[model samples]
Target: MATADTSETVAHNPPCTRRGSKDLPPDLRIVLLGSSVSENSGVGNFILGRAAFDSEAPPDVVERVGGRLKDRHVTIINSPQLLQTNISDHQITQTVRECVYLSDPGPHVIVLLLKHDQCSTEYQECVEKVLLSFSERVLQHAIVITTQEPTGTNDILQKIIQKCANRHFSLQRSSSPDDLLQMFDNIVQMNDRHHLDCEGLQNFSMTQQPTEIFSEGVKLNLVVCGSDGTLKSAISEQILQQTDRRSDMELHGRQISLVELPALTRLSEEEMMCQTLRCVSRCHPGVHVFLLIIPDAPLTVEDKAEVEKIHRIFSLSINKHILILIMQNSEHQTAELNKQTQSVIESFGGRHLFFGTKTQVSTLMENIEQMLEENGEGFFSTETFWEAHMKKLEEMLKKFHSLQTDIQSQGNLPKGQ
Candidate 1:
């Protein structure tokens, strides 16, 4: 429960002795991993490189990125913006060797920060090459973090887990300090309690496949409510597809059922209840992840409180089956924006994840797919439901046709009359 921010709660002094060489700073033992390209490089310039890390990175950043373990704190140990040797040139092996030779013994979290859109056929070779040459020992101490959103219907993280056959891991994806700290804290706790680090955590036996990704017989129904302009339809669609992929339900041989809720909007309380509760009641025995899409515009404290009140009321009615997904919008680029967004969600007892819509659609779909593949249950075949939806569509179209016919008939007679 005592996290990096809560270090004061657990101890009076810093937890670890500085472990790097005497040349390294006295209170730090940090290293940087990933494609460490400099500011002048490709997409790495904006994201993948040194600017993301700082020796004087705020305290929260340090705790989230480098977890505290016993009396020896493990920080990223390499310099920022330093590229690993090219693997195909065979220099990568030597570079990793040098890092391993220099790195201290015992447990460390190797943050694998991969570039975005690197899953294409062109970059697949490089991705595989890095994974291949990166020693198991290094991987065992690793916490793979994908900086780029995976392009397919599912996230690269979910793909990796599925490829490994539902193997569990402590992997994470986030740029927020609070989420990062929670991730680090979870890893450290898992390590201490289970005698395992990140790698060990990944390799541990996940007796049953995670319910989020797949359920044997259960159905999950989620309702995501965010501000207007969030990807409500897209989120719902991805959840549908991902669950199909991960569940035991037959995708190729049988049909899976799907019931989608109508888009929620600002409306009267009576209308809101009729829409939300109706959807939930219909999707009974299923888990509902309510996405609260928030815009980046400044919100007064009263506004924040109002949103929290709404969330609380919903949670009480629904029993906390809601996952609050914070849709990442353009206005939320500032550090202040990040802090406020986090505070608002945590205050409401709901979990949150960030999504960048400006990125490729494939990546967005992939994130949703990952969630469903990680969370869905029951069958995906929806023959009966689709039939019903189509019937409704047909009825609406018939009414429209009749109205057009009436209007044309009236127009033809009006001039003469």
Candidate 2:
């Protein structure tokens, strides 16, 4: 039997190319979610090699436009900032829904924009909320884009950001538009393999069990925070047993994933606040434990005030996550700092430990374990929790400004009115 008409078989099979398969989408549809409209708009223009989408004055609902990027037709949807605005989640979901139909099929990719310069508790929460709103199936198509202009030296930061979303890119990182096309090509390939967006995609994050928090394994996220000009780094190094070879300040014990943060009193307390919160949300996603480091020296008024501010910022589930770690200059110096810091410890529910040296973190770690056991990692509402944090920050900032105004006005009051 001569092989059944090879030409006919080949013609019928056609190797499953786009032309041989079902009708192809009119163009590539991508929805730009999250904040950073200006930067994202710029990125959209960059991808298309032209100013296709206007970044000015983000309007409510959704805006969809098509452009030509390289040889392929591309459709870009720029969505408004959801969490920061009055738009309800329903409205946001509906806007995303509109995006699906605007391209005549659905988005093959969702570009989530996260700005490096503006990362904060609110921003991270907004990002998590928006991304988490989507179903897990959509996440496979999701890509996080950071606005940080990457340099050759930023490989480590790039990797960290990439881990947060599983797939990440920087417009500034790629040398040219070709690099971007390659990324889009990969997305298209993977999307084609999955055959996603045959129907309008839904958005939602299922609630995780509180007990599942600690059961997630050895990914311990310990935040070492203190006032500006304190010995947070030094103390963290000691507690984490960071050897000379491990001088990066990250502790990689069999059971601990410790990260030492700079003083919360740094130039941008707002920035630091967001950085801390983002660290928890992205790196630690399950359970977060805070090591509130206080120096052994006298508790300066500034240190006390900074401690108060940290407390206010981390008010959500703080009672369960925060631990007071007092760093003393010497064994004898611990006595003085202990007495001086009684108020701080009391403020933190009297769960305090004084370490004359670095290896003294065992008891502190035990205390944290106990706290986790008791708390079981309660429900965390990303949007509500962080919006509340921003409100508290604003209130504290307003109060500080008011107090400064009072003091200045008092100085001007002739003869102490």
- Which has the greatest lDDT? 2
Put down candidate 2 lDDT per residue, 14-90, tens digits, no spaces.
12223312334446777776554566667667666666656663343255667765446777777756434344444
- Provide the lowest-lDDT 10-residue window in model 2: 1-10
Q: Write the per-residue lDDT of candidate 1 for residues 107-180, one digit (tens) a residue.
A: 33344444444434444445445544444433333444443333554365444433322322222232323343
lDDT of 2 at 267: 30
Each model's lDDT: 0.39, 0.55
lDDT of 2: 0.55
The C-alpha TM-scores of every prediction are: 0.29, 0.39
Error of 2 at 380 (Å): 7.1
- Among these predictions, the greatest TM-score belongs to 2
